[model samples]
Target: MLLMPENKDQLVSVLTYHVVSGKVNAADVVKLESADTVQGEQLMIKTTDGDVMVNNAKVVMTDVEASNGVIHVIDTVLLPE
Candidate 1:
């Protein structure tokens, strides 16, 4: 999955977001209030002006399926505090 070294950080965040639950769609995500990421931090789910955000980052593209789980592309890198 590390096709590019430059993407390692973003890749890790993407991978972490996948394991919270099984493959879930955008609509499903909207119904969820929060999810605990693999990084051990909680991701807050919120919708504003019809855009969905995980914590403070906006989900740009969602529902990308993978063998292990689903991937939701976000505008910013999520780091565990």
Candidate 2:
């Protein structure tokens, strides 16, 4: 993911939401309420019945990890507005 400096806060939050309580699958994300990222930002996660949301985006893919951290593909790019 490419996060610009201005979007650092949102980036951190988004990154955190991607992390699993355990080694997660895409389905596990729906159960998260929040997460703290490596960059020291908190991400708000939301799930309603059969729906799940992260900030203002949806997780289209998940559990893609790297040596540095994990990646969850979101349908929309998040920015600090």
Candidate 3:
């Protein structure tokens, strides 16, 4: 869903879904079935024949470093119902 600036609460929730609290690398991610997001939602994570999948999105890139945490780029935006 498209989140406008006016929808601050929802925008934060959606943004948080894309992020985890700490640095989670590919190896760590592959080991777990789920990761808890800052938004309080559990993200479904699994490796499909070696390819990592998160929810309905494919993790195209992993281990992108940032001061606060890491980033796993996905093929699609994950939305919570």
Candidate 4:
């Protein structure tokens, strides 16, 4: 099994894995099959039973607007393989 991130760089890599490089809304999110993150990885996106899943995380809340971008809340952390 892979070890958890133990350093700042590793933490940043894990954090950025959750982020998709643009302001994607919930409507657009469900339509997508996958997305690329700022950390230089591709995230697998899937919708099952009307719920959107990003990797293994479930998108709970979405479209939280910020000055720079939008935020989509997920139920779990997404880690790169």
Candidate 5:
């Protein structure tokens, strides 16, 4: 979806849904069922046959460290409903 800031709240919500507060690595991610985002929503996490999925996106890369947190690259853009 094209997230234009037509509604500032909605745009921020959508963006925040992509982020979780703490630094969650791939190892830690597979252990959890869901994670709470900064947007005040829970993101569903699933692992099947050694494949990790966050929401509807497949995790492509993991353990990318940043100044504040780690980054996990996913195949698709996730949209919250």
Candidate 6:
């Protein structure tokens, strides 16, 4: 479902759903069929026209380092069921 978080708790859930464990870069990301998000849902990964998609969100940028983990920017919001 396409979720537009209405409150703080819902917002948090949506954000966490976009995150996956480990520092899987762009190359490794395409090799996988799916990945487990930190929020406990599995994100389906796909490649089409040389672009990587996580669920319905497109991975526009990758390999950004963070203090806690790495970040891969996605074009759309992701939420758990």
Comparing 1 and 4 on TM-score, the stronger one: 4
lDDT tens string, model 6, 1-81?
325444767777777887788888888988999999888889999999999998898988988988987788889877689
lDDT of 5 by residue, 16-76 (tens): 9899998888889999999999988898999999999998999999999999899999999
For model 4, give the 10-residue run with minimal summed lDDT.
1-10
- Deviation in angstroms for 19 in model 1? 4.5
* lDDT values for all models: 0.79, 0.64, 0.87, 0.85, 0.89, 0.84
Question: Every model's Cα RMSD, please?
Answer: 4.7, 5.0, 1.6, 3.4, 1.7, 3.7
lDDT ranking from best to worst? 5, 3, 4, 6, 1, 2
The local distance difference test score of model 6 is: 0.84
Off by over 4 Å in 3: 1-5
lDDT, candidate 5, equals 0.89
Error of 3 at 19 (Å): 1.3
Query: Ranking under TM-score, best-scoring first?
Result: 3, 5, 4, 6, 1, 2
Q: Compared with the true structure, what per-residue lDDT tens digits does model 2 show for residues 1-81?
A: 347788776667655444444455556667678765444555678977765677787877666876755567778865433
Off by over 4 Å in 2: 1-24, 65-70
* Predicted structure 4: lDDT: 0.85
Taking all chains together, the TM-score of candidate 1 against the true structure is 0.71
- Candidate 1 lDDT, tens digit per residue, 1-81? 565999898678766664575567887999888987675668899988889998888999988888887788889866665
Q: Which stretches of candidate 4 lie over 4 Å from their true place?
A: 1-6
- Per-residue error for 41 in candidate 3, Å, reads 0.8
**What's the count of clashing pairs in each model shown?**
0, 0, 0, 0, 0, 0
Top-scoring candidate (TM-score) = 3
Candidates in order, TM-scores: namely: 0.71, 0.53, 0.89, 0.85, 0.88, 0.80
Q: Give the Cα error of residue 77 in candidate 4, in Å.
A: 1.0
- Candidate 6 residue pairs in clash (backbone atoms < 3 Å): none
Q: What lDDT score is found at residue 71 in candidate 2? A: 68
